[model samples]
Target: DVAMPDAPARPTTPELLPPNRMPKRGRGGSERGRIAMLHALAHVEYSAIDLAFDVAGRFGALFPRSFIDDWLSVGADEAMHFAILDRRLTAMGSGYGALPAHAGLWEAAGATAHDAAARLAVVPMVLEARGLDVTPETVARFEAAGDLPSARILQRIYTDEIRHVGFGAKWFGYLCANEAIPPAPRWQSLVRTHFRGKLKPPFNDSARARAGLTRDFYEPLAAE
Candidate 1:
């Protein structure tokens, strides 16, 4: 019966900045660059922990128990991701709060807060799916830089994210089915309305297909 907060509680440091104002995290080729990359990722994982739980807390009552189960699992995965990244940062002589993070990470959550389907459409289906598209390149860069441990970590996270996106697609389809609406168009509409960013190209088609987030849902939007 408790109400969801407008935004999640944040740590005092790593001063949050607008996406445009955030400092560039350079290519993961040098120690400084890698540390910056890891810290940014750690911040993402930390914010994701709250995003997953907020979905459960704010919208769980509208769905079956399985909804809560799925999101709680995602939250746990995010927690583990944050912990490992923080450890990696410490090993590299940096930590999570040493750099500013993108403040707009939670903007999607706030934008879609009123509708569970929109939340799914924007948060996991759009945002986390973007991770799948970009992470392989990131892992390769880490490996090329001789940062095998960080590469492996990114690889593991990439695999888990496929499942998380699958969950979003699953539940979004379920909700659409319940409403007798087509999932793809509905998802497209929600993304257009709730997501502020563009659906960039060079997408990972195979990985997205594996997660059931086909191009039909996003391609039309991307073209628009």
Candidate 2:
């Protein structure tokens, strides 16, 4: 087991994000706004890495140790995601620190900050799962834009994001089992209660299944 002297005593409120700047409709974006959102996402992933590291360092004695490593790896992969997206956005004549990005992801991070179980549920299962579904569409957009390089980047993001969300599935199942709740039902219940956004059509079936979800888990979810 391991521990850290400097792990945060509690969750910290993020200070640097600008505001909710995601486009409401399909609209053209400037380089600056894209860059700003990338920077904001980077800040989040970087903080996730730190949180994972700290959890491993300070609380290894209390729970499973491997999750910490996984979370750290998740952070690294998200950092790569941020870097690639940011670079592509920059190459398009934009840079980070220009537009605003909602703190929704980070807010989820904070909401689950105090509980590893909640973190696993909200961050990867809910958020990164959305990324999984979007990756292919993003690639298509890139290819349509004549940006093969960006499409390739999105392909990599899709692959990595699947694994990241799988981590959530694995650990969330474990937690539910620990509390004597069946995994599938528990997950369905959570999604119904917490999520408010409209889940789009054209789900990534192969990717979702690869991320440890079965037809039983997804069919009902997709129907909702």
Candidate 3:
């Protein structure tokens, strides 16, 4: 079931662009503005589906059955999330590809393809963990604006993301323990070697702790 290049089919619309080239998501105060926000979320979940599968299919053999089980479940959840957002967009007369999305999401998978540990660290620990930090506020913004439906969807995604990050931390810790490498330093080393962006702060320390990605794992890596 492995595709050679392992790249998913690119969506046709909204035009993919480099992160810097993409415009900011406008405040969701207007109908158009709200559509844009949902579209952006749809794009991320769509890309996430591919990322989850890529991690499993591309590197599953390196680990055991539990690894495959976790990632496959993550991939399935991402697919469903994408469907939910896309359906919401359709109800609003816009769809997933109606606006451009960040093109850099898949780069993390490509960057860490050769290292299972790096893939877990960057994708789940760093990338998905970010969702835990920001999604609650995003959910509140929708709720404050009287868009409880959108807020509910985000709430569901946020809840699922906690477990996704947990899977990354769990597997990464297992790998470290199996090899007798110190988990924190090895994680830091992997991030330094593999991740391109800086770890910005105002972290969701509580949710991250629940995911088993405690402050000790990422705090030292945050920039001053």
Candidate 4:
């Protein structure tokens, strides 16, 4: 059985904002900027703990027992990641909720709540996969600034996110196969229907490929 309740609401602190109103995550040149960025990453990880559990609880009944196993593991990893980030923030004399976070992440979850396929497409495939593309540079920035501890934390999250994305792609493929739908085109259609933004490029194709989300799954859908 899944371990969490259905669609638990996020916390009230950190003063959630719409995506447009959130401040820019400035380059990690100053301690203030670095703390803000860590706070942002912490918020994402905290929200992800909910996302992993929500997906498992809300959709687990429709799939095999392994589905719950995989997602529950993902949730555990997200929780660990959040704890690490929050501790890192405290070590920096800051912590989670010290900065504002956007509510767009959970909004996407809510939009795809009823469809497992759509949920997989939007959250892990699109959003978590996007993390693969960007996190390397974030780690590098921290490293270049002589912030090895923070860089190491982000590097670990980057590695784990690859597997999280793999779980999404694997389950999505299973459902598509059972339904006699093709993977790539169906993914495109789902993104068009459920995702609010365009699929952009310069994607981390190698990392995506490692996660079973190849160019074939997303390249055609890239905004031209």
Best by lDDT: 1
On a 0 to 1 TM-score scale, where does candidate 1 land against the true structure? 0.98
When summed lDDT is taken over every stretch of 10 residues in candidate 3, the lowest stretch is 2-11
For residues 8-115, write the lDDT of model 2, one tens digit per residue. 442343344434545432411433433443455445555555555554444344458677777778767866776776677678675444444445655555455456
* TM-score per candidate: 0.98, 0.75, 0.95, 0.95
> Residue 164 lDDT in model 4?
98
Per-candidate total of colliding backbone pairs: 0, 7, 1, 0
For model 2, what is the C-alpha lDDT against the true structure?
Answer: 0.62
- CA deviation > 4 Å runs, candidate 4: 1-7
Candidate topping TM-score: 1
- Using TM-score as the yardstick, the better of models 2 and 4 is 4
**Sorted on lDDT, highest at the top, how do the candidates line up?**
1, 4, 3, 2
Residue runs of model 2 more than 4 Å from their true location after superposition: 1-21, 24-62, 221-224
> lDDT tens digits, residues 25-44, model 4?
89897778888999988888
Kindly report the root-mean-square deviation of model 3 from the true structure over all alpha carbons: 1.5
**Model 1 over residues 105-129: C-alpha lDDT tens digits?**
6988988899999999999999899
Clashing pairs in 3: 14-99
lDDT of each: 0.92, 0.62, 0.88, 0.91
Rate residue 60 of model 3 by lDDT: 81
